[model samples]
Target chain A: MDLFIQLTLTGLTNGAILAMAALGFVLIFKASDVINFAQGEFLLIGAYVTFAMLAQLGLHWTLGLLLTLGVAVALGVAVERLVLRPMIGEPIISVIMVTIGLSSLLKALVSAIWGNQPKAFPPFIPSQPVKILGATVGEDRLWAIVIAIFMLGIFSVFFRRSREGIAMRAVADDQQAALSMGISVKKIFAWAWSIAAATAAIGGALVANIVGVGPELAGFGLRVFPVVILGGLDSIPGAIIGGVVIGLLEAYTGGYIGQGLNQVLPFIVLILILMIRPYGLFGQEIIERV
Target chain B: MLTLNNIEVIYNEVILVLKGMSLQVPEGKIVGLLGSNGAGKSTTLKAISGLLKPEDGEVTDGSIKFMGEAIHHKDAAEIVRMGIFQVMEGRRVFEHLTAEENLLAGGYTRRERDLSSDLEMVYSYFPRLKERRHQTAGYLSGGEQQMLAIGRALMAQPRLMLLDEPSLGLAPMLVLEIFGIIKRINQEQGTTILLVEQNANLTLGVADYAYIMENGRIVLEGYPEDLRQNADVREFYLGLTEVGQRKSYRDVKHYKRRKRWLS
Candidate 1:
């Protein structure tokens, strides 16, 4: 029972990290109908930037985190304008290929600059452990969970209340109509990319504090796919729920069930969900014309 | 006032859709362009709305002069801003937006200062839309979606309205109601209208002047009363010839287009 409890808490912490990365993917997909394969690279870049700020520049951890997010947001905007915009209305396969190619490029660039070594990220939270319901968890882990939940909440409000958010939703529904209504579809695409990049940066930073930062940070971007698929690609609430469910499953399986199911559990869930409801839990089912 | 002179449009450089189609709608009159499925009625409207550029079609060969200016060169959104609004055949309302949001988007070209009044006027036209203003457009019934599309177009405050098959997919009652509203808009707002319809019965009933198009060419043109009285038009075109042979107005375009063959 103690082992189960410990595993569950740890799983939840990891799930929170997955949710953060998934949020960025959802934003870009929703606004531009572009699957950003480079989303993972954004996370990796963000963590390195944060590490450099804190360790090399001697900035405070909190300040470093903020600066890292700002940089990520800028990177997102630059990518939209430079990479995504030129490929507008291109074949979906071509667009997907572009993003995958971009991911490879970013991974190579990161390795060239930072080398293939892991670095410690100083935790913004105090270096202490907390006991919760007889299970011990690190303060940084708890902070990761809390911060992830908070960011998701903030994003929900942005989607529900902000005019720009509604405009983005409108564009997602019908790009031509949205453009006809004078909503600059290009601007919405840029904003979506920026927000997604910013979220990935924060996710990267949080993961670095919990685990050592490395090129492997890019893996989290791909890891988010299961959560996003489970949650529904377009659903914000689904992302949170999907994240928690996957987290708990991973924890329980690793601790009790054992074997390899834990490693492939998310993929299994994603496949099942997709087969049953191709749009996932919250995805809008579209009827194609031809 | 709007005019389309010899606007030719080919879909893929091979499929000739609109072949030298020309039309004119005088200020504040309801003109009807009647045609069958492949006759290019919708394509003609699309050409005027700037959705498709003619590779082999040019306004100079036949020009589109709107309010005495060449508007064929203008963009669709620009033409919309110039007060030409199209209620596309399928009632393509933004499906995800609430009814009111759809209406708000319609007024995209309006000044921010004039939006509130425009909103009120649209509500006055379709009070049902006001009641369901918060409901997403997808949930609206077929008839309601058509109403919302028209109301949205009205929000643009167009001087000339291009209505493409407002009766399509609608029940008989809704079709009649729609035609009634079209007449009311013309009578009350004094807006000129170029209506395209595959339903010839409805077009002839509502139009001040009617043009019968077949194979992307205008085969007949006249006042509604004159077209109704024509013997050959009534028989072969209007589906009225089966009733009986009656003395009717003479065919003009048939005579004109076949001048060389006749002479």
Candidate 2:
């Protein structure tokens, strides 16, 4: 029971961070139908930029975070304008290929600037051990869970009630129809990219605090695919639930089943889900009448 | 309020869809543009509303003027901000969005206005939409989706509303209901309308003036009453054999008869 509690708490913290990264991936997919291969790179870039602001420059944590987000926004807009916009009307496979190429480019840029060696992340949140439900965990882990949940809740409301959010969904539904209604499809794409980058950066920074900043952090993007596929690629709530579910499963498997099995289990489950419920638990299936 | 002056539209720079198509939609009037399928009626509306560029279609020659400003080069969003909205064919309501959200999306161009009142106004026109406002639009019945599409257009509060094939697929009764509401919208709001349709009888019933297009050009145009008296219109559209001539039990398809203007 003690082991179970420990595993569950740790799983929750990891899941929360996974949910944050997956949320950004889902956002880009929902708004632009582009399965972003560079999603992991966004997280990597975010961590390094925040590291530079906080550790190298020794800026205030708040200032560093804000500056990091600003950089993210600019990066997103520039990428949209320079890289993705020109590729509009190109084949879906070609667009996907470009994103794959983009992932490599972003990874290279990070290594060029920050080097390949791992760096210790600047301390922002306290890592003091705290007890919840008889399970001891770090204060930072608790904070991660709280912050991730809060951000997810805010995004859910934004997509539902906000005008900009509705516009984005409208564009997703039918670009031509949305254009007819005067929604700037281009602007929506920029917004999607920016928000996706900003959220991924936050997730990256949190993960950096836990594991330290390194190129390996980019691997979180690969881990997110199963989460998104399990949840639903176009679903925000799916990301959260999928994150926690996968997180818990991984923890339980690692604790009980043995080494390296946890990494392989999620993919096995992902394949099963794909074969059964292809749209995932909460994915919207396009219903067309004959 | 809208004028297409000998506009030439080419798709992918080769396939010419609209060849010098000229038409005018005066303010506060419903002008019916009647055409058969592939007659460029939709393209003309697209050209006027600047929706062609997205389809790799371009206005290679001529000009489209809206409110006395040449707007052929402007993008769809910019043209919409200047108060022109197109209710496209197939009632392309956002399938995943609720009916109310679809309506809110229409009011996207104008920022500083009460959308709730606009929603109320749309509900008044389409009470059915109000009932189904919370329902996802993709699941709505065809007639209901049609109403939602029109209600969405109302939310935009556009001055020149370009309606493309409003009667595409619907029950006769529902089509009549929709047309009645459309006429009411035109009269009450005093908004200029360019209505493109294949249904000549119903279009003539609602239009103040009408144009008949074929193969990307206006073949003939006149007041609906005048066109009704034309022999070609009588035989082809109304299925009249001749004045006091014997009528056959079989209603011959209009396509079987050659268009006098086209020939």
Candidate 3:
């Protein structure tokens, strides 16, 4: 029972991080229909920028986090304007390939600046373990879970009440209709990219505090593909639920069954879900009758 | 007031759709544009509202002036912000959004105005929309969707409303009901209107002035009563041929060959 509790906590923590990353993916896909292969690099950039601020520049953790988010927003806007704008009206496959190229470019740029070595993130949170219901959990993990949930709540409210958020949903529903309603589709696309980058940066910063910051940090993007797919690519709540489910599955399987099963389990579940429900658990099913 | 002078629209820079088309819509009047399919009625509306550019269509040789300002070069959002709204054909509501949310989105440009009053006004005009305010737009019946589309446009507080085929695919009773409401909106709000429709008799009944378009040109223009009295218009558009005389196919073909308007 103790072992089960410990594994569940660990799973929930990891799931929260994955949910944060998957939220970014879902936002970009919903607004612009781009798969955003460079999403993981946004996380890496966030982690490294935060690391530089906190460790090398000697800034406080709060200030470093804020600066990292600002940088992420700037990067996101620049990418949309410089790289993606010209590719509008291009084939979907070409646009997707462009994102894949962008991902490789970002990775190479990060490596060129920081080198390929992993660096320890400064301990922003204390290393002490907290006891919860007779099971011990790391303090940083608990903080991560709380922060992730808070960000998700903020996003939900924004979509429901804010004018810009509602406009984004309108664009996602129908671009031509949105334009007719005086909503600028181009502006919405830029904002979506910016918000997605900001969220990915925050997710990266959180994950970096756990695993040491390195090139491998970008691999979190690849791991999150299954989460978004399972949740429904366009649904925000689906991202959280899918993340938690995948996280728990990994924890339980890897804890009791075998050593390497966690790494392969998410893909297996992804395939199963795809076969059963191609639109995803919460995705809007497209109905067309001839 | 709206005016189009010698406008020519071309698709793909080659296929000419509207050739030197021109028309005038007086302020605070309902003007009807009657045409068969592919006669460029919708294209003319799109040109005035700046929607032609999206479909790779462009006004190559004309100018559109809205309230004395040249507006052919403006963006769609800019045109909409300037108070010209097109309730597009096929009732293009945001399917995922609720009916009320759809109205709120239409009021997007009028963010500074009191949206609640405007929303209330729309609800009053189309009570069916208010009843289905929380339902997704896609699930609404065809007649309800049309009401929602017009109500959505009304939320814009438009000076000039361009309605394209409001009667399309609707039953005759529903069409009469919708058109009755449209006439009320024009009379009550004093909103200028350019109504495009294939149902010529219905449109002419509500219009103070009417234009008949064929092959992208205005072939005839008059008051509704005058057009209804003209023998050619009565036969071709009003579907009344020679007072109970059943015209043979040969007579119809001959009439087309010798169409007075074409000549």
* Residue lDDT tens for model 1, A92-188: 6788899999999999998998899998767766648899889899888888789889988998888765657766877787766555444567788
DockQ ranking, high to low: 2, 3, 1
Cα lDDT of model 2 by residue, A80-101, tens digit: 9999899987886888899899
**Cand. 2 TM to true fold:** 0.97
- Residue-wise C-alpha lDDT for candidate 2, range B126-228, written one tens digit per residue: 9888898999999999999989988888888999898998899999999999999999999998878889998889999999999998899998999999999
Output the number of the lDDT-best candidate. 2
Candidate 2 wrong stretches, greater than 4 Å: B243-258
Q: Of all true interface contacts, what fraction is found in model 1?
A: 0.18
Best by TM-score: 2
Interface RMSD, every prediction, one decimal place:
4.0, 0.7, 1.7
| Candidate 3 lDDT over residue span A157-220, tens digit each | 9777667887788888877778887888888888999999999998888888887699999988
Please report how far candidate 2 places residue B68 from its true position, in Å: 0.8
DockQ values, each candidate: 0.25, 0.87, 0.62
Per model, state how many residue pairs clash: 1, 0, 0
- Flag the better candidate by TM-score, 1 or 2: 2
Clashing pairs in 1: B235-B241
- Among all candidates shown, the one with the greatest DockQ: 2
Clashing pairs in 2: none
What is the lDDT of every predicted structure here?
0.81, 0.91, 0.88
TM-score of 3: 0.97
